[model samples]
Target: MRTTRSYLALALAFVLVLTGQSMALARTAPGPDGQIVLCTGTGPVAVLVDDQGQPIGPSHICPDCALSLFQALAETAPEIAAPTSWLRAHPIEFTLVFHSPAPRPAVARGPPQAA
Candidate 1:
């Protein structure tokens, strides 16, 4: 009986948490021309933006996209972006090396004597 109640409580809590998150994401701010800004993007590859179209923190975008965004934002000096074409040109190569200590000579022993 206790187990059943505990499981029910856990499930209810899970549902409540999901509902709260969805509600938070569904929040929209009034946009220009009386339009409401809606959360956009599919799956985890999402970006939450403010009414001004500026991105908000704690977005759901992918890790790679977040990395690129941060790298672009941190650029202080004027420099060309790193080329990624070389990655496809060169194939990944893995090398494995094994090393073992010199083997010791086996010594012949007679039957064990009673201690």
Candidate 2:
């Protein structure tokens, strides 16, 4: 009986650790539009804006990947707004945004080479 109990406990612990790891990988993001967006693992994503079209803090459960993206955006887009109070009260919506690299302008060919 003692051996059986010990085995069961060990199995349970292993299962718990696996579950936690899975959850960490799948981080969740919140949108201000009352929607929850989950990081499906594509690239850096942004949170949706609320009714006022403003960014909001993540919901209670901040996923690891989502947090990383958020921190990056916060550094660049400091002007981005968030609904702190609303997020505190309601569940946050996590969404993904696809961002493309900006194109560089071509250099002028010396004032159009007077033909």
Best candidate (score: TM-score): 1
Q: Which has the greatest lDDT? A: 2
The window of 10 residues in a row where model 1 has the poorest summed lDDT is: 28-37
Q: In candidate 1, which residue pairs clash?
A: none
Task: Let me know the TM-score candidate 2 reaches against the reference structure.
Answer: 0.25
lDDT of predicted model 1: 0.63
Worst 10 residues of 2 by lDDT: 28-37
Per-residue accuracy of model 1 over 3-112 as CA lDDT, tens digit each: 99999999999999986676555454232332334555743444455667666645344423445776678758558888866644677899999999999999999887
TM-score per model over all chains? 0.26, 0.25
